[model samples]
Target: MRYALMTLIAVSLAGCTRAPAPVADVVAVVSASLPSDPADAAWNAAPEHVAKLLLQDLVEPRLQAVSTPDVRVRAFTAGQEIALRLEWPDATINDLPAAGRFNDACAVQVPLKPAAAVPDPQMGMAGNGVAISFWRADWQATVKGRGDTIREIYPNALIDHYPFDAPSLEKGSAAQQKMATEYAPAEGAGNRRGGARTTAVEDLIAEGPGTLHPAPAAISRGSGVRTPTGWAVVITRPLPDGLSPTSPSQIAFAVWEGSKQESGARKMRTGWIPISIREDQP
Candidate 1:
């Protein structure tokens, strides 16, 4: 059935000269920078080519585990090509087998909502050299099928690398950091709104043990990166049962440093989704 569905989609899409694509919702912290043309407009509206590129390059490979998809990706875009984000919802993990953390490790009861994950800058035949932030927080978790061999071999199991990134730092261990780096962004450090305009910002790529980060990212002081000061995310995990003042379900986020050992590094103060986030036809 899954193969047939993908086949059907491929055939259907193949027959079309032009297909609707995914659109990215651009939320500008500084107004007046938003794209104006229909061709350039961010989320809720975008060209088909953008969506097609994402499906071909990123989405498809990540979606092999999905048995059925309710929402189809529509488009993608960014002033800063460095960080490209694709928007869509995935609830399939809720259907995976669960046997309470042994071998047949089932996913947490929480369903995955519409979310985006960062595609590797190295994905293309030519790697895009820059730091790309896909799901700034919660959505960063890795998703995929464990396959029959792995599942059969380890029935009452904890699917290795099961929960992607946790909202709390304490929840993710050194092992998780090593595994999460498999999906973490390239260690470029700093958001490039475009080729130019490198706002001075303090950023860190936390990895394992002491503020786990991947590669060491160098930022010149006069380079003008946005200076978001003093943060040290130790790890990423979901909000503990009740901790955040804002919606407790929010994804943890940071551009600089990481959660620290000081206190509450493992807690989410708010939920992640915002009104400007995009939604596709489901």
Candidate 2:
């Protein structure tokens, strides 16, 4: 059933022709951070794209209420790396789970090929693939405050004996992390037992719906923070080696607000937007 629904989504997104972003609206990425201190200056100073996203109910796994309506994107490029900062407003803060539910999230999607007709915005279509960098609010909370831990997520849960934290061992916190690696190497470097994760951001690629998978060790990284109004996220990647110097590339965006039960194919998303090198922009 899941596979069938995913196929439907890919076909639907493919049939819907998205308008290409105009040249005037192309985001200009600069050579360096505008301010000396990244924190001292508001990151919104960069070229902006205000996207009006729509609910993802056109396919399967639909949702309601939790859709974030507006997404503000600011972008900049410094030397080899390009960064995008995304912002959206939501009244409820949904970083933690209630019952068995999940937390809020967002992502930035860009096509792997530079000059081709942009891939289907709802993941991708057929052989054309899109690479995505995801940011989850729950992971951000874990990285901050007390660090990622199972106890943190499930406050009342009890543990008999955690192997990572043997009282007799002098290594203390580091011991458990090593034990975690030994136990679940796929879990990566971390002391927390399933609270959040080592990295709040994840890199994934999709050739079509239901085909989302880990990217090929690509160089992409990012971070995010939540506020009373909404979320602020930043994603960075190196400029592709063979990108055409004259043509504008494509990028897309999506948001998943967990508080309103947005998950899977349920969330708000946008189609392709144009992006170009700062030096080339007229």
Report lDDT (CA) for all predictions: 0.25, 0.69
Flag regions of model 2 displaced more than 4 Å: 1-26, 34-42, 64-66, 97-99, 162-196, 240-245, 280-282
lDDT of 1 by residue, 1-282 (tens): 999999999999898655334333222121223332212234233332111111111332232222212211222222221111122222222212223321100000111232233212221111211221212211111112224233434577675454545555445587666655554444223332112122222233332113323224432111110113211111211222222222222122212112211111221111122212222322
Give me the candidate number with maximum lDDT: 2
State the weakest 10-residue window (summed lDDT) of model 1: 102-111
Instruction: Estimate, for each residue in 65-132, the C-alpha lDDT of model 2 and write its tens digit.
Output: 54688688776677767777777987777777557676788888888675447778888877788888
Name the TM-score of candidate 1. 0.22
| Residue 96 Cα positional deviation in candidate 1, in Å, after optimal superposition | 15
